[model samples]
Target: MQPEIQLSNSTTQLESTQNKVLRNTYMMLGLTMIPTVIGAYMGLNINFAFMAQHPILSLLGMLAVMFGMFMGIAANRNNALGVVLLLGVTFLLGLMLGPILQAALHFNNGAQLIGMAAGGTGAIFLTLSTIATVTKKDFSFLGKFLMVGLVMLILASLANAFFQVPVASLAISAIAIMLFAGYLLYDVSQIVHGGETNYVMATLAIYLDIYNIFVNLLNLLMALSGDRD
Candidate 1:
C-alpha cells in the first residue's frame, strides 16, 4: 500500500512537470511567429529568394540555412541566445517560404486555398498534439527512420525538379505529411516526458514539424485544387 501511494505521487509530479513544459513551449511557439511574419513580409516585398538567380548561390544559400538550423538546435541547450537565434532562423525560413506563397497567390482561388490549407494544417496539429498528450506515447523510436526518409524525400524532390515528374511530387508530399506528423508527435511527447525542458528548443522542434506539415499539405492541396485557368 505504501509503495502504491509513492508510485501514485511520483506519477502526479511527472504529470505536473509535463503540463508546465507543454504550456511554456506553446507560449514561446506563439511568440516566435511575430518575427516570422515580419521577415516574410520583408522578403516578399523585396522579392528576396536568397537563391533566385544563380544556381551556385542557391546551393550555398541552402547550406547556410542548414548550418543555421544546426546551430539553433545545439545552442538551445545553453542560453536565451538560442531562442533569439531560433527566431532568426525561422524568419529565414519564412523568407524561403515566400516563393511558394507567391505561387499560391497567382491562382484565382489562391487566397482561399491558402486559408483552407492553413485551417487544415491547424486541425492536424491540434489533433496529433492532443493525442500525444493524452496517450503519453513515446515516438522517439521513429526519429532515425524519419530522418532517413526525409533525406530520400529531399533527393527525390531535387530529382523531380529536373525530371518534372508529377507522380514523384505527389509521393513526396504524401510522405512529408506523414513524416512531419510523426515528428509532431515525437516533439510533443518529449515535452510530456521531460525529455525536453527548454521552451525555446521545444518550440523550435514543434514549430519546424508544424511548418513542414503545413507546407507539404498546402502543396498537395494546391496541386489538386489549383485552377490554372
Candidate 2:
C-alpha cells in the first residue's frame, strides 16, 4: 500500500509538471509572435537585392546564423536568456520571410491568400495540438521518420534551388506543409507525454513547426491561387 501510494503521488506530480510546462510554452509561444510581426514588418521595407544576386550564398549565410542561434537557445534553455534567444531567432526568421512576402504582395490577391494561409495553418496546429493533448498518445515514434523526411526535403530543396524547376518547387512546398503538420503533432505530444520537460525548448519546437507550416502553406496558396495585377 505504501509503495502504491508513493507511485500514485509521483505520477500526479509528473502530470502537474507537464501541465505547467505546456501552459508556459503556450504563453511564450504567444509572446514570440510580437517580435516576429515587428521584424516581418521591418523586413518588408528592406532591400534584398544582394540576396537576389547571390541566392546560394544568402541561403548558406542564413542557415549558419540560424543554427548558431538555435545552439545558443538550447544551451540556455533553463534560463531567461533562452527565451530571449528564442525570440531573436524568430525575429531573424521573420526577416527572412521578406523575399517571399514581397513576391506574394506582387499579386492582386496576395493579402487575401496570406490570410487564408494563416487561417489554414492555425486550424492545422489547433487540430493536431488538441488531438495530442486530449488523447495523450506518444508520438516519439515519429522522431526518426520525421528526421529522415526532413533530410530528404532539404536535399530536394537545395537541388531545386539550382534546377529552378517551378513544378518541383510547388511539390516541395506541398511536402513541407504536410511535414510540418506532422511535426506539430509530434511536438505537442512530446509536451503532453512529459518527453519534453523544458517549456522554452518545447515552445521553440512548436513555434518552428507552426512557422514552417505557415510559410509552406502560403507558398502553396500563392502558387495555386494568386491573382496577378
**Each candidate: RMSD:** 2.4, 0.7
Pairs that collide, model 1: none
lDDT tens string, model 1, 1-229? 9999999999999878878889988998888788878866776666644455554557566767768676766766468777778878788777777877887888889888888888988999999999988988887787788889889887887777667778788889989999889889888988888888777778888988888887888898889999879
What value does the lDDT take at residue 134 in candidate 1?
92
- Give residue 56's error in model 2 in angstroms: 1.0
> Model 2, 59-128: lDDT tens per residue?
9999999999999999999988998899999999888888888888999999998899889988998899
Q: Could you estimate the TM-score for every candidate?
A: 0.87, 0.98
TM-score, structure 1 vs. true: 0.87
The deviation in Å at residue 86 for candidate 2 is 0.7
The local distance difference test score of model 1 is 0.81
Off by over 4 Å in 2: none
Q: How does residue 152 of candidate 1 score in lDDT?
A: 88
**Winning model by TM-score:** 2
Number of clashing pairs per prediction, in order? 0, 0
